[model samples]
Target: MKQAFLTALVCSTICSLGAPLKVKGLRTESATNPIGVSNSPRLSWQLDSEERGNFQRAYEILAATTQEKLDEEKADLWATKKQQGAAKLLVSWQGKPLKKGQKVHWKVRVWDKQDRPSGWSKIATFVVGEQAKLLKPGRISGFESSSEKLNQLYRQSIANLEKRLDAFTEGDVAALGDGSAVHRSARAFLYHFDSVPHLTEWLRLMDSEITKDNFFPIYPGAQTTAPVSSDSGVLVTHPLWWMSGDAQPTRSRWDAYEGHIIAREAQDTLLKGTKWGGIADSENVAAEFIDLCYLGFSCRLILELALPAVQPQKAIRFQVYASRIRKSFERQFVNKDGSLKSKSQTGHVLALRSAVLNPEQKAKVLADLIALVTKNGSKVGPIGAHFLPGVLSLTGNQDLALKSLTSLNAEEQKNYTESGIAEWLMTFVAGIDTIAPGFNQVIISPRIPSNDSLSWVRAYHDSPTGQISVYWKKLSPDSALKAEVMIPTGALSRVILPIRKNQKITESGNEIADAKGVEIIERKDGKVSLITQSGKYSFLIK
Candidate 1:
């Protein structure tokens, strides 16, 4: 009897310890703007955790939509673990790119290494907006912002974006789904083009179906095929949207153009000096122009990242990008109200992208572009519909950007809510604070700044590799304040400490990364410091 009792006790203890990790302390301190909101509607959660690590974890983040069968991999919509820390988890809910308005219930779940789940978190519902926020004398932030924390947050945040991109490249519906022309995704840019004939045919069809360059690209409302017996059509719960790769019947024709010269020959022969004019020669079509511009943008970045260039002739392609955008800018776009229909008109007056033009001309061209978008934006607006200007602008008030949106009627909001766009602007202002001294303020700690009873708590474990870090770039006009760094010890395998300056983070341990996962404390004395396992490196904040 004694031996049986001891065995039973041991079994019970092990089962309790090995139970699937539970998620508690569920509170949303802040809902930063959903990512790629204008193009891809999403929800972001900033929650403070009282629970520690469950060590090796797997998360199930999904959007509960009208559809019963929710396949994230098929849908192309995905969730990512973002803003990870010792005591907080910022899980962003990203819905797939969808047609006008689709409501969704998004939530997340975490699983331990043992494959048992702690259950899903609360679902936050939101609608996808066709247009992101346009400047309306309001500040814009988020892209390549200067805030150190925001930048660091990008490390975690972009992981999600990278995965999102890969979904499209890997031939998924979510990635292949596109709702417009002017707002083509990175996925659209890489649409299957193995042959020139196929590419040409596809572009022609795309021009009519969804190119913003042609006109308002979205389908007229009520034209979509709703699910049977349901008034509410299919909802976009995943990021990868409805993709059926059969759109291009002859996509294989472009394979012959692989020799570099074929692409060039097509550019010069079919397009140059004739009605089908080449990109550099000023007669380039808007679709072609955007395509080359994106290609060139990609090339520049790949070269910068030290990735080998597949086609060495990309340098020449760069020369063609300007002609595309410039010609489109100069062309008389079909206007809803006689507005210049080009990205330059939407903004982009100061792209330090190329050193080809003289400073005066470059500035003048950029200004002209901004002026076009700012002046006549009201006629054909919701700038994000066009993609360029709505995102690129960041400053004091988005008054101009807002104007570009052409106010949406209540009916329109049903399909095009600015919920995420509004938050993106908040992040936008924070970004400005990091660039210009008086641009805006960036809030570091208290990301979800709240006095609510909604917070949750969880358990944690210890590992040398598991760590956390919190960063802040002087957001206030004054110097750094006494910020408290909170880390959930349960999730950490190991802890390290270090400080970052001018975007450079330095670590301590030689054998191990000192406080690599540790947090930061930037004090008023112009010194920055952090606690590592062994010691702390302190520097006064300026």
Candidate 2:
């Protein structure tokens, strides 16, 4: 009896040595510690203990949308009810759909091998940082100029963009799910082609789509389905891809004169003459011009967007090809008088964007194009409908860009057009241009457009460096513009804000009279420029 009692005591002591099972480390999908963007993110946790043989037999995970719910032990969002398994990685979330930017609070408890239940682990938290939508703008509220009405409109626009980008998926972009092949392709260029923060990933997505269509020449040859020239080096309009195979059968038969020409041949021919006509089956003259301009843009994209990010050796051959196409575009499209042969919006935009003209020529062309668009009373074509605003902004025509975006009524804001507005606001208006390869450096130059009513503007961008924000307010027409900028970590910036002659500039409420790491770069075209390191800066353009 005494031995039995001693044995029971010893067993009890040994049981006490087996510490309770506890979850020590927790992580979301892709091992994102605190920031996660996946809507249906998988959760994983490591069951830990000091005692030997204390393995996890089962686990119960609880996730809450709010910290309050989590603290109160209310798993209102998601709860894995006593899942019996050793699977600790990528445990799927069978719960309510996660909204963009939702913060999730989660904790887990486990049952040990001996069936002893452990207490809930410390409540860990993660923020849903990766939203499928455009980065949200910072809040701006005050009783100033047109606050209630304009603010509401801005919010609505942001909400719409969020919804649209959230729904935009890889499949949506690749298979022309959103529209026809041309439309989807244009949308891809507008949204993510050259300027997305994730440059490499964007290129991958674009390359996949282009490769799928066999990288058909811009113009398809006599054979509508078969390319008379399968060589990508040659520039042809593949009709099926161009118009979604909608051209009447008759047009295709007569336009076989210039069926397929190698890049070299096209370049030489274009340099000699201005007649860059399409095949018989091709679209109208203006449409053909637009198609050719897009072809040039595509080739330029290969150089500008894909070249630096890809292997240098792999890109060298394409680099040569792209340069020839650009030069050909310069020779074929633009007249000696800095006027486009097509005299269309697409022609003007592509000419300005391709940088094929000399400085004097560019200035003349910009003035003429501006006059053309303004004279046309904003009658932008389909291709122009997408790229015109961005081109205007790029050419230092912000007021016109604003007019292009806002002149369209609420009902007319479709066809991926608002993306241009967003781009202008976030990039040109806010003045956040990525200078380095991956936002390593930035040029933050905010300008007040001619729209006098826009007394204040605030914009944000999620660059590769991090979140960059710019806000500016014109206290009065004659008063200087007050601008605030938040530069992301690991980025240097050159800030250029509008200022009148003899006006002073202040950073963070202190006159930058003797600031270090800050110097006047130049005063050009009514804007004062300063180079600065990364930090939050507030400038009074007095």
Candidate 3:
């Protein structure tokens, strides 16, 4: 009874205001939060009470050209809350059957519990997006035409990487002499980013020198090991194994540091001979690390492009990466009792992390990752090796990935004093941010190789835009085919469509046709066909 009386007293006190009610907020302010011409609309306002009521009470709203007499009474609305989401007073109404580029006006009205109207509000007007001015002929303030085009390009770049494999049998490429590892390094490093011509040119140069007998040592079961500084340049080498030695230089801005990783890995394995698992010094270790790094880079790019949402490769590349990591683990780190022989638990974790994408594989991968954290000082330097697994952990529905990012060391966790993990640590650390940012490292203090020259195999194309991008020049000049096409009147026509000369789209894959982008069509006689250009398939890359 006492509480109720207090509430009544408070309510009574709230009704004794003397100022006249004032309507201050106008929702259609284009000055801020530019109004959008889409399904969702933003509204805002400020309403002050002119007089007090027995209770801090009710309100109504109306919209029309004239604030004067209203013949057709519209629905009355009310608001009890003192404040809400953004503005002091904000309410929104969906524009029904909204016309394109149409401009409309509106206003709000209010009333108290005693049933007295507080007068109508000032007029506010809004204009929808002009159709002819936009890409489409309709109201569309929500979409940015420029941003949409960029999004399309990003999508197209990824599509090209997937449907096609950028790899060429070593036998096809020629040897780049001078042993400086500059051109050779570029030729061998491969990843999703290699879609750029610079990377493909390098891959083709390296690929030419790779004969079938020298490239693959044993196909699937092949070892990741490379002979450190061997006798023959391109003789009968490992047939099944993918050679990753002689790491390359950092190519791009973001790639400078991250690219070091690829360079370190590929340099280590493909240098010359196998010594300490082929990872020798800073430069050499960079090569070994790149071999592992490229796999993650490619997987991330492919997933980001084609299936923006469906990640973790749906269990394809992860398995392949795991097998190689396992081979390395057994070679150097494993103990007789199935326990770690060294304190670098991260190394072991990195070796086994690829399997985490699989629910069944997570248990094993998690055990290794956690063991590294538990047994070690929670340092993430070694964690980098299993970067792909860590990404999978964060993305593969694993609670741990999103759970405060505990795995990030001093360098990784900015809030922490010692968050960063060294790039050349005995055990590599995982990349947390989508794109791994690093230093201008010259492969110094290297723990493992991290770069690759010929690491990716892909195909690409763009439609309506008449463009194509690839990692290697695998297309042959002898291969050229006709592509029916359709060209947008003002747009540039005829794209350099790579095709096997007189080659039909038979079984194996597109001989010369683009693997990704849409074929610009030809609407001749009301029939649609693709417009194309003869691609220069052969290269004298030396």
Clash number by candidate, in order: 77, 13, 121
Model 1 lDDT, full chain set? 0.31
Model 1 error, position 190 (Å):
15
RMSD, one per candidate, in order: 16.9, 15.9, 28.6
272-319, model 1: which lDDT tens digit per residue? 221221122121224343333333333233222121223345435534
TM-score of 2: 0.56
Please, what is the TM-score per model? 0.31, 0.56, 0.24
lDDT of 2 by residue, 94-163 (tens): 8888776788899998887777899998887766666333222222211122333334434554454444
The TM-score leader among the candidates is: 2
- Residues 257-291, candidate 3, lDDT per residue (tens digit)? 22322333454443221333344423123344333
Q: Each candidate's lDDT (Cα)?
A: 0.31, 0.53, 0.30
Give residue 273's error in model 3 in angstroms.
Answer: 12
- Model 2: how far residue 58 lies from native, Å: 39
